[model samples]
Target: MNQSNETTMNPPLNQESVSLEPSANLVRTIAVRERPANPGAWSNTVAFGWRALLKIKYVPEQMFDVLVTPIMFTVMFTYLFGGALAGSTADYLQFLLPGILAQTVVFTSLYTGVTLNTDISKGVYDRFKSMPIWAPSPLVGAMLGDVLRYTGASIIVVLIGLVLGYRPEQGLVGVLLALVLLNVFGFGLGWVFTVLGLILRTPGAVMTISWLVLMPMTFVSNIYVDPATMPDFLQTLVAFNPVTHLVSALRGLMSGGVTLGQLGLSLLTPVILTAVFGPLAMRLYRRKR
Candidate 1:
């Protein structure tokens, strides 16, 4: 055989193929390389979710605000405006309870966008992209995190309401059902906020723009006061506010007096809001890079 033929027969192993070689160093390199950095299911969204949970777990104090805020809001409204709104503390507590539950949840949902903006600005998402993971992991993880958040906020709000003499006629099952609806509502709302965060360049900007959007959605609705008490223009706008439908749904479930029509509106509103915002949010997220 000629020299050229001999060289072809005994070709040298390249760096990539050497990684799979059986020699100790080669094998070690292979193991280091062949092992997927972001492995399995949690590698993507589930991983992100677990990471967020762990972060919160390590920082237990983050939840303190969630627990305390509900109490503060209920107390503020009950003691300050009890007589003005409902004529007595007992009556005010009951009516304000539903309003507090709905408003607290709606406001808390803003964290989704605000937190998302921080993650983006901090280059954390870029790290996720570099890892060996699915595209949907962060989205899945963030959404799951929101579930826990909503649960904590809702439960605390309910408990505070109880301490203040705000008993739901629906009792335990009613409270649970209200929580379920709120959880579902919050879950969908997070997607909208996450997308919003992706579009907004700064966390403060996200909060500012979103608050402007959210405040109107909450106050313009029938949460704290009945729409009939409002001006005609405000009443007309309230008809279109999804928060009104959500509060109505929660109130009906809590009071054991919610009609099918109200329930339908309640469930329908969050879902529709999700649909409208979901696509835009995802579009904004992808458009980033």
Candidate 2:
């Protein structure tokens, strides 16, 4: 039959109409795109986070560093500088534990960059490129993972101090508050390091940079000494140093004399850090990815 005549013969059913409701067959015909357009970005973040956790599961040492490194630092500093700083070992441990815990948390944040660099070099993140995961997840997830490190590190140091008879006059609540501040402060620092690691070329380079960046921030703070004891310029620096505020806040709480200035600075530093670093990390992370 001629094609024109065949079409004309089939056109007679104008009175009947077909409806278009969504159905399996309709979807198959109309919605054949291979991947979702938006790709459920939040869910992808959760997935990426879960993946990092799973990787950490296979290597427990990723977590153990938090417990061990901080403890070692606390012990070393207490014994090494205790004699000069305080009259006796017992007195030093009590006076020094909180500062060491703060220092430990700051030092502990360095590994965020190192491990993040390790993952990038090992092609661990290459898999992420091919997946639907949100790009910010790895950077953020790594930071979150290290919050555990901060908490664990603080707890270990505090427990060791406790066993050594480093009692806080503020008792249980102070101790708990100290741990909370440590983790929050350290978590913000992790974001800073995590951003640096993602952009840095190598783990060793990241480590070197971490030391350069962290030392001044840690030492200039009131971590191990009172600001009044330092030189005038340094005392001013220590007075304004965020870590010092954190240490002071924790110390004040432990010693049962919370000052408005310490409390204000203590609350502000971590919030400022995370607010500043959070966006920077996300931006750098997206660029690198």
Candidate 3:
């Protein structure tokens, strides 16, 4: 009788142990499956960047802004404002080409935010979060891929300018350097837009906000006309404008007369913008979820 009672009690304990074993194994299996592989930052960034490039391949229309817009603006502004602003199209082309390149690259950077916001709204970012890649891979990769657009715009503007008889007296090397500087500035400025994308509700709203901020700066700067020609108040505004310094630096590098002061300011502007906006963007990105 005692043996029977002990056996009955012991059976329950054995069954409990059996049940616990499977539960523990199941938890281990789940943990192993859930743990993602840690690819280093550089490799992850490149992989994600390739994804962005593939997106452009599938949707070639995205190139329109970099391709068509630069051509149209180069032509329109050269003819429309050339004669009035600088006496003739040929003379104006020389002065206007570099400025146009600056404006085109800077303006193009705005789209980075718009596209980012679109991705977030579409739940693409959430999908990314599920992957094992570095948290910042998406954002950094997108921005890196955008360097191509900036380069394309710079090339298109320069090619159009060449066709319009706008010569870069600084030659190929100088033109290349100027392009490098513009891309740097564009990349740094893009971080600010990235932060906006993180916080904004819609892509359209991001674009509108970017335009409102950019238009006034572009119009008031020395991109089109000499700041000296403007009234005192406008000139004062131009004097402090970072765009003005960028244009001046480009003109100097491309036209063979960039001053030390202009070069220093041009280099410093991107550094300052990146320092301030880059961390802000990353912080916002981390808090997104």
> What would the TM-scores of all predictions be?
0.82, 0.78, 0.84
Which lDDT tens digits does candidate 2 get at residues 43-71?
A: 66566567667877898877776678777
Which digits, one per residue and each the tens of the lDDT, describe model 1 over residues 233-264? Answer: 99999998878888888888898788889878
Q: How many residue-pair clashes does candidate 1 contain?
A: 2
Candidate 1, superposed: residue stretches over 4 Å from native: 1-29, 32-44, 58-61, 130-133
Q: Which residue pairs show collisions in model 3?
A: none
lDDT of 3 by residue, 1-289 (tens): 9988887879988788888998999889888856566779898888877887998999899889778988998899999999999999899888888888988998999989998887766567777888777787888889988888999989989988888788899899999999999989898888889988999988889999999989987889998898889999999999998889999999999999889999899888889988998888888887786
lDDT, each prediction: 0.79, 0.78, 0.88
Candidate 1 similarity to native, TM-score? 0.82
Top of the candidates by TM-score: 3
Distance from true location, Cα of 58 in model 3, Å: 1.3
Clashing pairs in 2: none
